[model samples]
Target: MNSRFDPSPAAVPPRGQLLLVSICLALYLLFCLQQIVLPFRFFGMTLSLGSVTMLGCMLAISAGSLVRHGVPSELVRPLLAILMCIAALSASVLASNHIGLACAFAVRYATSLLALWAMLSLAAACPRWPRAATLAALIAVWFNLALAGAVWFQWPGALRVALAFHPEETFKYLPRISGMYEHPALLATSAAMVLLLVLRLQQRGEVGRISLALALVGAVLALALTQVRNTLLPVGVLMAWWAWPRSCTSNRQRHIARVALGGIAVLAVFVLWLRYPDMTSAAQENMMTAFTLGRTYLWSGALDAWREHPWFGLGAGVFQFMVPDYTGGRFHRGELHAHNLLLAALSETGLFGLLAGLALIFALWRPLLRIAAERQWAIAWLILVLGLSTFDFYFPFFPFSMHAALAVASLHAGHCAPSQADGVSRSTT
Candidate 1:
């Protein structure tokens, strides 16, 4: 019984719960992007209810805990703002051009945001959780990578057997990766994220580092082989953060590595784009097209939406609805989501909403800034670049935004770890 616990000033979590949530949020968005392309038939419904349930459970548990334990801080303001934003979203749907679809979107958004809020709050406040959270994320990535490998290796034969029953398609067929996901790019994206997180954990000397490292290397190799350019940014972002945490690792060497890696990344991207001319086309673009970062069409649509409604904007998930009505003939036939985060906000929530949302990031990020000032470089790097990778709608449908927000929040919450006796040193999940 050597383990002693205290919640006094000497042992408390500082409230950086949002940090873990942010990274998870990034993974969550990556997950959502993949989920959008499924054409499956489940009881005549193609949509995945699994995602809906997951987010719902997150929100429910968080809300339940909050009710049971209670919290007193300015943090509650953001939660209230999120709730109000959701309410405003409901109002927008009530006035939406397509009430039915908008309502569906609203349900999706509300549940996601609520879950995100709870997860971030809880992650920060919980005394014994950082390792558990890290483990949970690792498990998700590992599972996805395993599934992708199985699908990639088996797709050709599986397709042939399935095609024998319905050989009446004009579309060309190819055996590609699909992991546990509906699409190959998403699978690759998942692998890429897992690879980075695993590497970080390994670097930090977490358990299973070597095995996970080997697995991570394989995943990264496969991810690159898949050639999804959209997949590159997150991986690239993580690497930069991994290697670029202040002057901790000799600035001269770090600069050389950054330049070398940046140059190599650029060269690789150029080669892939050359091989696949029509980047957005499913067949023409190399598996590498998924990693490319030209999301102008979606961004413009978001801008047009913002121009129309700058105050409360189109109301959360209503951006998808606004996509068709606002921007015309510029993008793909049925594409939703602005590829860029800034553009998505400008289009969906407008100036005010975007500011409110970003303000949350800054508020949470400020503590990390202080940590960085004290030379806590890796953590700071994570914060600055988290939002740089993808455009996360404040929409509940996109889990990444909340993940990012919550992770940052958790880290900040953890700063007051004195209340838990020795805080970080004594904490476990």
Candidate 2:
């Protein structure tokens, strides 16, 4: 078959473009590792070298796209949506008790949104970008595993140096190995995301059998070590969703089997709960207190704040300070933002902000649907995002959220213009 007509060959992208994209991805990976690996700050500023690199990459991609394509038409609606979300969230700052802190957080949120927009635009322009992105994510999975091994083996030099730069509280008491992230949950969520990506890549023949096996094992290990139930549950659901159809011989059988399995699982859980009511209650209580009442107290505080200011709610960054007040003085911790994404939006920005967020998600949904027929994994990624967001904040501005945006863009854009995947035209630049 002619290389141009071969979908597999066309999807690999040109060597030159791949190299450039890989360099950018490498820098982005460094940004992910800045906390524990290369903690070099740019000048005397608080911004790390990785942050500067990421900023530079975003600026360069934006500038090049403007010169070549003059702002993609596909980006118009998403950009408008982003602007509305930012405006809505920023407006809540007016109602904030600590105006200064709220304003700072608002600014940070706005910046992250714009950065996300730029990344999506870049991905839409280059269809093969997701290939590089998957490889990058795999590398991150391995890097984290290496770090975990370092900690477990007590490699004096490596462990000592990495821990020296880590936050004291993160490792001072808790023995959980966070690896490259500041928190174990963060690491677990990221690993879970990568696991899905690796599986998809393998399905598409973009990854080898050996590589896929290693990545899945590493990602699973990371999740187990982190012990984050919130992430583990979602990953389990996604894995089941991914494997169900493959396990059946036909669509009808697949549907029937899925329904049967789901019913059985639910019934079993119900039976267990009924049989061991006290045990179930004790387990729930223990999980809640695992991390000083875990997310229950934080969620309670968020709901209380939202009820107090239902319309506009408390201002951005206000939840941390008002935790004690909202939680009936039970939570005295400082700087504790809402752990749940929906609650964060409702409590900090209120109805208007929540609506704007929905609008943004709706805007992105179009392209995602457009690619769904060819790239089902994109929908799986979306499911993971929403599922994880219910327990932890993964919307609008987390690093993982930004990466998700990039991955989705790559999938949508690649399907939209398969002809350009081989870098046949300068327009892709």
Root-mean-square deviation (CA) per prediction: 9.3, 6.7
Q: Estimate, for each residue in 148-213, the C-alpha lDDT of model 1 and write its tens digit.
A: 455446655644432221222301213344434443454554454444444444444443534355
Candidate 2: worst 10 consecutive residues by lDDT? 1-10
> Candidate 2 clashing pairs?
none
Q: Which candidate number would show the highest lDDT if scored against the true structure?
A: 2
Candidates' TM-scores? 0.66, 0.77
Give the Å shift of residue 128 in candidate 2: 1.2
Which has the greatest TM-score? 2
User: How many angstroms is residue 30 displaced in model 1 relative to the true structure, after the best TM-score fit?
Assistant: 17
lDDT of 2: 0.64
Show model 1 residue runs off by greater than 4 Å: 1-48, 72-74, 77-81, 84-88, 155-176, 182-185, 211-215, 234-246, 250-275, 279-294, 321-327, 330-333, 372-413, 416-429
